[model samples]
Target: MKIKSLSLAIISATALLSGAVQAYETGDIIVRGGLASVNPDVDSGNIYAGGVEQADQRVDVNNDTQMGLSLTYMVQDNIGIELLAATPFSHNLQGKGGLAGLNDFAEVKHLPPTLTVQYYPMDNSSAFQPYVGVGLNYTIFFSEKFINGADATFGSLELDDSLGLAAQVGFDYEIAENWSLNAAVWYMDIDTTGTFKNANGTGDYKIDVSLDPWVYMAGVAYRF
Candidate 1:
């Protein structure tokens, strides 16, 4: 009877210690926020010549900075889901050449909300966590402004609403118990249509533009 009692006590103690270790290993909720920069390659096609030519027009977009916040829930040690929110980014557009020279520079707004499924393959003992996510983006354009020295206002430039696909890959390295350093890169494919009308309304033109942007971000994350 004494041996049996000792054995049971040992088993109970071992189970409690095991449970404590597991509780420490699994994180229930994580919150991380950071800043990102948007670098977009803007390309447009002319529809008038029956053949699509990559326009020689050079349009420069101002480098813009944006902030993002995300919440993650760990379903298991290796898998999670994250919802991303960020501030709206505004861009100025300018071009030169052909009829392009006739159009003035304009400003537009783009907002992208992303949700991704994350996978952490090395969650057991390593401080590095790598993840990948795929999501949808809806871009809204507003508050249009035309550059000075141009003949037309933004009203003369036509742009349609867009829905796009987004994908990202990033990683986080835990620097401390509550802080982690992170870096990520994302790709977004967005398409739009713009109509340019002459000031006299005599000549109307249409343009198809693709603004596929690549985003790079590096910042610190805090877990609560």
Candidate 2:
């Protein structure tokens, strides 16, 4: 009876060691997509001399909803690289008080493509996976329009092309062997300047706006 028990213990230890070796040899790729609401903390500066309360001009921007896709390639147990893609986000701008009747409203569309390097400290665990990322983003603006009342007309709004920094914190919960749910928050520090012009005697004006936005997203990811 004693000899039988010792043989069973040796077999169990060998099986556990084999499982650990198999775990170290596995690689995973994950694809995820989600939606985010982008809220911009906007500040505008007017370049025209004697500009009417440019510093205090109340600017209105519509809240933007954006969809994004990310592809991650895990190079090791706890490190990966991700590439992110998204559609263009459009926003409307309106002047509230003194210039309300002038060329008051305009629309601008921007596309930001980002790339990140991520580190996962808990990748080897079964229940929880947390990650942090730092990256760079580039923004391009297009499709601009101006509307102000009866004298409303079309013009060019100048937005300086910008490069910015991005940061994110996120976590995932494994629900099954090949599936997980994810939630994340990201932030970008973007600075931009634009010039608004109108053909109607309203004169050409410039605005310097800062769009530092926060993004919140949740989605499911599939691993292979």
Candidate 3:
């Protein structure tokens, strides 16, 4: 009788231990912070200024890095809604291809706020979770300034705001019951028209720039 009682107690303890595994559940909130890098694959239209076409005047934008933040809420065991935010990103404009040597021709700062619905493709109790997300992105541009000869030639610069689609793939590796390490990569469709004006506002130029970029991030996440 003593031996049978001990066996039952051992099995009961094992079951309790198994139930202690932490998994994502409804109403869970996750917050993540890390570094994000934005690298643009630019395709720019020819620059037309003062009714004159500049030959091969394509543009290039340099990559920028900034602090990244993501907030997630679990609506179900495997479905999560996430919002991405970050510090303002700044990019330096340059000339590309036939219009080379126009580095730092201008600078602009912008913010991209994205909302995604994510699907996790693993059991909730698994230590590693991989997810795919599709969402919408809105980019707001401001603080545009010209540099070098471009400034003297074109006094005012502005970039049109963009509305586009965003896609992401990411994974989280569990480190503790409520802690995890995360890595993600995203592709965003960003198209903007840059307008430039003379110092006296007498003339204007327009260039359509496609700044589709790949964004990469890695950071730590905490669940509450």
Candidate 4:
């Protein structure tokens, strides 16, 4: 009888340890929140005047940060569908090249919604899980303001919306049975055409700007 009791105790102990190591599982819902930064690597073209190129005139944009949220639904132990969202980000625009020393020439607000399919390489029993993802990003721009207290210098600012491909690599390290720390980086393709009329009334000027941004996030995740 004592031998049988000892055997039962060993089985119970093994089961407890096994359960402790399980991080994420099928049908689990994970939510993460923290700060996210968007750093644009802008490739801007020269300004055009009524379809004619104007040399030495270009646009430059600066970065912004806001609250970031991520939601994940586990389809399998190793696979998940994730959505990334954030508050509207505001970016400051400036001039480059011959247009240098131009600060806060314009400002705009945008929101990017991204959907991704992530593959976690580790099993459910591992506390550290790294993932790679492929996704799509759509950005909408609004509330464009041409500052410098000289609204008459430039007419309405128009920035075209963007739809592009995105890729990400990230990791989650389990700190508790239902909590983890997450760090992620994403690269998105964002291109836009900005057009505004010159106050001097030299027709409308257009610029083809590629704002391919790298996004970084670090936060705590809760699994439910």
Worst lDDT run of 10 residues, candidate 4, spans 149-158
Question: Whose TM-score is greatest here?
Answer: 4
Per-residue C-alpha lDDT of model 3 across residues 31-52, encoded as one tens digit per residue: 8889999999898988987768
Error of 3 at 22 (Å): 1.3
lDDT of 1 by residue, 1-224 (tens): 99999999999998775443331135667777789788877776654323334465445456578887777777777777777666888887756455456443677777766667777766444667778878776777766555565445324665687888888898888777657888888888878876655565555556677888887777877666
* C-alpha lDDT of candidate 2 relative to the true structure: 0.71
> By how many angstroms RMSD does model 2 differ from the true structure?
4.5
Cα TM-score of candidate 3: 0.91
CA deviation > 4 Å runs, candidate 3: 1-21, 50-53
List candidate 2 stretches off by more than 4 Å.
1-27, 47-55, 96-104, 148-154, 200-203
Give per-residue CA lDDT, model 2, range 1-224, as digits (tens).
99999999999998775444321113678777788667777665654523554555555566688887777888887887777767778888776556555444777788877678888876364446788999987878888766554225536667787789998888777776657788877787778877665665456666667787786778877677
- TM per candidate comes to 0.73, 0.78, 0.91, 0.91
What's the residue-level lDDT of 69 in candidate 1? 72
Per-residue C-alpha lDDT of model 4 across residues 57-158, encoded as one tens digit per residue = 898899999999999999999999999999999998888987787766888999999999999989888888899999999999999878886466887678
Off by over 4 Å in 4: 1-14, 199-202
The window of 10 residues in a row where model 1 has the poorest summed lDDT is 17-26
